[model samples]
Target chain A: MLTEILHTLPQVLLDGLTLGAVYAIVALGYTMVYGILELINFAHGEIFMTGAFIGTAIFLTMTGLGVMSAMPALLALILVLVVTSVLTGVLGMGIERVAYRPLRKAPKLITLITAIGVSFLLQDLVRFIAELKKGNYIITGPSLFTNQVTVEASSLFSTFNNAQLKSSSIILIVTAIIMMFALDFFINRTKWGMAMRAVAQDRETAALMSVNVNKVISLTFFVGSALGGATGVLFAVQYGTIDPYIGFILGLKAFTAAVLGGIGNIRGAMFGGVLLGLLEMFAAANLSILSGGVLGGEYKDVFAFAILILVLIFKPEGIFGKAVTEKV
Target chain B: MNLLEVRNISLAFGGVKALNDVSFTIRKGEIFSLIGPNGAGKTSMLNCISGLYRPTEGSISFEGADITGMKPFKRAGLGIARAFQNIELFSHLTVLDNLMLGRHTKMKTGVLAGGFYWGRAQKEEIEHRKAVERVIDFLEIEDIRNIPVGRLAYGLKKRVEVGRALAMEPKLLLLDEPMAGMNAEEKEDMARFILDIHEEMGSTVVLIEHDMGVVMDLSDSVAVLDFGKLIGKGTPQEVQENPDVIKAYLGEEQFI
Candidate 1:
């Protein structure tokens, strides 16, 4: 067991990174919305699920039209990504306008309850759509690419001489990194991004500075949901199947990642996500050796939450979150 | 022509009349100060001009355009900038970012260009940075430019608030108690900055102040409000010597 653990460490790290990338992307939706409006946006997980469905629908349509067969694989994937992200972005905006906007000034409890209701509504809506299309509840996404594209890790990294890195994992990590940097630049450097931050800090001040508060909030939902949609498409591509219920646990975990990283901090979300992912992967992979064969891989899901509880019990502000001093 | 004209503006929250039939004109290139005792409707009048509060009745015009119905952001776009009495700086943001936010109306980059942060966005950001740097330099806050405003002292935060308003390059600058909570030295520095903003920057000014010494020394014209009514309006000497103004401040009237 010890020998097997030593041999599989590199693969576990790669798998952790791949999974971490998706969680980080999804976590952004929660963190961004929370930053601006102080709302949890519980339906955000549903937004992620919807993105996968939308991407699947687009892929299926393209295949039916014979475009997928004729087109280059990269271009087709890009097209799917763009379409799914845009559609999801719009859907996210709609959700904000319909469900969250009216409750902007309402009590926190009212907004929270609305968020949960919206989440359930989206899940049931997706399930109903799938029921109509397939005469059943579970909807499996089309296979857009090979499940595993193997690349000998020794050719790229001298340390992983015996490991074969999956191309999908590479794509996921690269894409997630690019998007994260893009988000960072947007929030820190851009005029709109500055407005978003200002609005997050103080809505009245942002308005005084000529920022349209409503517009900024709507754009936030759009951008955050877009990232979630992109992640959904990536998740479907990697897993090769999805359903209406997929976002339930994934979204909860992503929300946990947000809280673990410090809910309102962008960098915290990414850090928390990758950390959570790595911890989960390591715990799942090394359980037999670490726990003397008593604990099995079946308890893998428990590890993420257990670590979260332990870390949060000590550092409630989260690993990346600064301790906020409440002003009188 | 007047840079800002307030005609018969009144604001009431239920039965509480904050400003009643208040009328004033801020001429171009003049330092106009609004001074009054506490709950004297000074901030309420400022709120009306900045479009934070809709006047219960009356009209406000800037540069011959009616802005009574315009939104706060629209008022900002029309080149009206304000620094709040309570220091409403974005506390989490650095001084540079806070001032850059003031230049929001001046920036033309949209979401796509801003997200890319290349070409037009990069060029636009550099231009805005130069503008904000000028404000930081003028306020002498260059040392704290990169620090978050939350960690700053009271005087520095006030300076950053004014710096942010200055970054807008407003034609009409409304400052609400810009030197409210500062020490003597800080008050002097703020007075100098306000004078420089009026004289050197050529921006029209409307200020709300409680410091009698500062108000007398700095204002070209002063308007005094008492219990939501304009009780005095004149040059510093004239207002200081006005019977109603003296009565409102030192009178036996109950504090509302």
Candidate 2:
């Protein structure tokens, strides 16, 4: 077992990176929404699920039209990502308008409950739509590039045949990194981004500076949810199968990732996602050996939640979060 | 023509009148000051003009346009800027970003342009950064240009607040106790900046102040409020000589 572990460490790390990239992207949605309005957008997971369904629909439609192979599959993938992101962005804004905005001044707990209720509504809504269209609840995303060998590179770190890198993992990591870079630049450099940070810091003062507070808030939802949509497409591409229920546990983990990174901090979300992914993967792959077979891969999901509970207990602020002393 | 016209503006909360029948006109290129003791409605009057509060009665006009119903952000877009008494800076952001936000209306780049961050968006950003740089120079906040506003000293924080207002290039600048908690030397520095802003920037100034010396020296016209009533309005010397103004400041026992 030890010899097998030594041979597979690099592969496991790569797997973690791919999974971590998805969580990081989804975590951005949670963190950005929380940063602006200080509300845990529980329905965000459903928004992400909606993106996956949109991707599945687009892929199937393209396949039927013979456009799946007419152009490079990458272009179709990009189209799916962009279209789903935009649609999900609008959906996110609509959710905010309907469920969150009226409760903006209400107590925090009410908004939290509303967020959970929204999560259920979106899940059921997607299930209902799928049932109507396909006559079943489970949907498979159209296969693209899963069999193609885009790259065949020998493993340099380990002298093992099992360590050969896959093209799918490469694409996933590269695409996720590009999106992360774009998001970071947009938040830090743009004027509207600055307005977001300002509103996050103090809404009333940002409005006084002529920031159009509602517009900033609406844009926050747009950008965050759009990212969530993109994340859904990526998840579908990597995993090959998605259902309406996929976002539930994944969304919970993404939320955990956001809180793990530092809930309201942008960079923190990304860090938290990647770290959570690595931790889960590492624990699942190696924990049985490390613990003398006391814990196995079945306990993988348990590790992420345990980390979350530990973080909440030991350092509620998370890794990249600063402890703020609220002024009276 | 009056730069700001507050006509019969009355604000009340239940039975308590915060401002009552207060009418005043601030002419262009003049320094106007509002002075009164605690709970005397000086801050409330500023709030009414800045659209933070909707008055119970009367209308407010800016440049002859009735703006009594305008939203706070829209009012700001019309070149009216304000510095808060309690220093309402975006504490987590750097001084440069806070001041750049002061020019929020001047920046026209939307989210798409902002995301691209090239071509016209880059050019517009450079232009606005130049404007903010000029404000940074004018306020002499160069030493702490990149520091977060939350970490700055109180006097410096207040200066950044004023700088933020000036970044708007406002035609009408409302300063609410800009030097309320400053030391003697800081007050002197602030008073100089206010005078320079009035003369060089040519902004119409309305300030609420508790410092009598700074108020009397800097103001071209003074308005005194006592129990929500406008008891006096005139030149500094004229207000000084007014019996009602003296009574409001010194108390009835001193007059007796």
Candidate 3:
């Protein structure tokens, strides 16, 4: 039994890494926007789902037009990425302008409810559009990775199946890393980045120093939304499916990741995502041994939430987050 | 000619006029002070000048350009900078980081280059760091350079805030209640820093202060306000002798 478990370890680890990469990408959007605005942005998940659908639609249209060749397909994917990212970025800004901006000085609960409303609105709009296009709610995404690639390893480690690890996961991780590095550079090196940090640290003081407060807030939404879009496209590509409601659970998970890493901490979000992903995978693989029941396979979410609760109770600032104490 | 001009500026919240047709001008290299009893609109006037609040009427011109409705960042770009009444340093960031933020408007590196920490970005960052270090050393906060501003004591935090504004290297600097909530020693230290900033930097300084002693000693010229209106404007002794200014302070039993 021990040997069997060891055999499954490498595969489980691979699974965790791929899953964690996705969570980390999505969690970044949550953390960055929260860092600047202190808003939860509940509609971020829907924005991600929209990106996936947009990419799938582009791919499908290209295939239908007999342009399934690799070059054209890749070009089409790039187009989808640009289009989806721009669209979602604009949508995020729109949400801020239309829904959140007016309610900024309002109660936090009101802002939260407005976010929920925006989420529902986006979900339903996607569902309506899908129905109008295909008379079906489910949208099947293109499978970019169907060929199996096996890498042989020493007996000390379990054999790995590269095919099971989607190329989309690799792409997602690389893109997320690039984007984060870019964000860091923008925040630390550029004039705008300095303005953003200044605003985040102290809005009134930033204004007093002649930093444009509104522009910084709008830029925050744009960057956060663009990240959400990129994560969405990656999710659809990895899963080989897209649905109008895909963002629901994933959004909550990403939010949990943000909170776990320290909601307003950027690097913390990335770390939290990977940790949450690994924990979920481990719980799914091992929890079944004790219960010998259904809790092992599909009950990973329950375990994830349980971990989230425990983290909140024990270390609320998260692994890398600093606790804030205001001077009254 | 004045380098910065405020013309007939008035600001009201609801029905209460915070500032009413208030106007002033500061020449280059001058240390100007705005003094008043509590609620005399000294800070409000500074806010209007810094572009934090749009005047209900009238306009502000800096360097011969009309900047009445320009955004705050644009104003900062035009070489206007300020330190707040409350110490508003970025608590999570180091004192160096806070000062670097002040130098933000001067940075010319592109986002792509900066993100990758490439050649120009690296050079620019190093240059900014050196500049920030100069400010830090000038302020004598080198011991706490890497420590987060939040961890600093009140006096140190206030010093850091001043350091941040000085980093901007503004043509005109607005300081709101720079010595508020400070002990006598801290106030003396701050007063010395302000004098050094004026003499060494040669930047125009417009300050609001409740400490009459500091104002009397430091100001080249003083503007006095009472209930949103200008009651007096002159040298410290001239304003001190004005009956309206005296009545504005003495009539209120709270002025003890």
Candidate 4:
């Protein structure tokens, strides 16, 4: 029994890492936009979906037009990434401008409801548009990067096969790492980043410092949306298929990751995503023991949510979150 | 010539006049005080000047430029900074981080340069860090520099809030009830800080304060407000002797 558990350990670890990376990417969109605007961009999940659809559409179109060769595929993938990122980024900004900007000084509950409304609106719009052109429930696209380069398992771990690690997962993880580092640098080093942090800390004070609060808020929405777009594309590539409803569960999980990491803390989101992913994998692997049932295949989500609840109950600020205090 | 000029400013909230045709001017390097009883429109006037609230009538000009309809941030870009009556420090951030946020407007590196951490961005960040550090040291908050502002004491938090506004290096600084709710010792410390900020920095100050003694001691010019109207404006002694100023406080005492 121990050997069986040991044999599956590495695979669980791999699964966790992949899941965590995806959650981390999507959680960044939630955390960052939340940090700046102090409002949850409810439509962020839909934006992720939009990105997947855009990327899938672009890749399939390129393939149909005879641009499926390696070099051309790489170029087309880059084009798709850029276009999809811009489209989703703009969509994010539009949501902010139309749904959130005017309600800047409104009550928090009003804005929250508006955000929910926008989320449903985007979901319906995407569903309607997708229904018009699709016969298949899942849209399949050509792989943009699928060359498998396996790392051989050492003699000590002879039973394990490195071939199980997909090139797409590796690429996604690397991209996520690069994006996270880039985001950290942007937040810490750039002028606009400073403005964003300032606005987040105190909007009135930020304005008093001559930082254009509106422009900073808009830029925040754009960057957050762009990150969501990247995550969507990555998800599509990893799974080899894009479905309109892909964002629903992913969004909830990512949001859970954000809360786990500490909503307003960027570094927290990254760590939380990776940690949540690992936990989900471990639960999936040991479901029989955890659930005490013969069929434990579908308990991954239950386990993930269980972790979320436990964290909230014990460490509400999340693992890395700083406690907030008010001065009288 | 005055650096900040207010002309016939009036504001109303649902038929209640917060300010009625109020006018004032502040020159560079001057310590000006706006003193009034509670609900006498001191905060409303400051809000109007800071662009947080629009005046129902009249105009505001800074450095020979009309800023009546400009956004609060735009007004800030023209060298305006203010501290809130209720401390609004970013609770989760360190004192140094709060100060660094104050330097946001002065930073020059764009997102592209920031993303890569290239030459210009690095230089800019280092320079701003140095400036923020200076403010921290000046405020004598060096020990708590890395500690989150939320955990600081009320006095220290107020100091940090002042430090944040100072980091802006504004041409004009507005303090809303700087010593409100403070004990005598805290009030003295805050007063000294305010004086140092004015004398050493040579930035113009427009403060709204309720403490009569502190207001009289700190202000070079004093404006008195009684129910949204300018009852008196002159030296501290002049306002003290004004019968209308006495009546405003007298009426409040009787009602209470």
TM-score of chain B of each: 0.97, 0.97, 0.97, 0.96
TM-scores, one per candidate: 0.94, 0.96, 0.88, 0.88
Give the candidate order by descending TM-score.
Answer: 2, 1, 4, 3
Q: What DockQ results do all the predictions give, each relative to the true complex?
A: 0.86, 0.82, 0.49, 0.57
lDDT of 4 by residue, A267-300 (tens): 9999999999998888888887645566485888
Which candidate wins on TM-score?
Answer: 2
lDDT of 3 at B201: 89
Q: Fraction of the real A/B interface contacts present in each candidate?
A: 0.93, 0.78, 0.54, 0.80
Which parts of model 1 have CA positions greater than 4 angstroms off? Answer: A147-164, A288-294, B252-256
iRMS, model 1 (angstroms):
0.7
CAPRI tier of model 3: medium
Residues B119-199 of candidate 2 have per-residue lDDT tens digits of 889999999999999999999999899999989999999999999999999999999999988999999999999999999
Candidate 2, residue A44: lDDT? 89
What would the per-residue lDDT of candidate 3 be over residues B1-256, giving only the tens digit for each residue?
Answer: 6998889999999999999998888788889999999998988898888777999999999988999998788888888888989777888777877888888777776545654677887888899889889899999999999898879999899999889899989888888998889999999999999999999988889989999999999999999999999989989999999999988988845645
DockQ agreement of candidate 1 with the native complex: 0.86
Task: Say what the RMSD of model 3 is.
Answer: 3.5
Candidate 2 displacement at residue A205 in angstroms? 0.7
Best by DockQ: 1
Query: Any residue pairs clashing in model 3, and if so which?
Result: A210-B72, A210-B73
lDDT of 4 by residue, B1-256 (tens): 6999999999999999999999988887899999889999999999998999999899999998999999998887777888989987877678988888778778877766776778988888899999998898888899999998879898889899889989989889999988878889999989998999998888899999988888899998999898899999998999889888988876635444
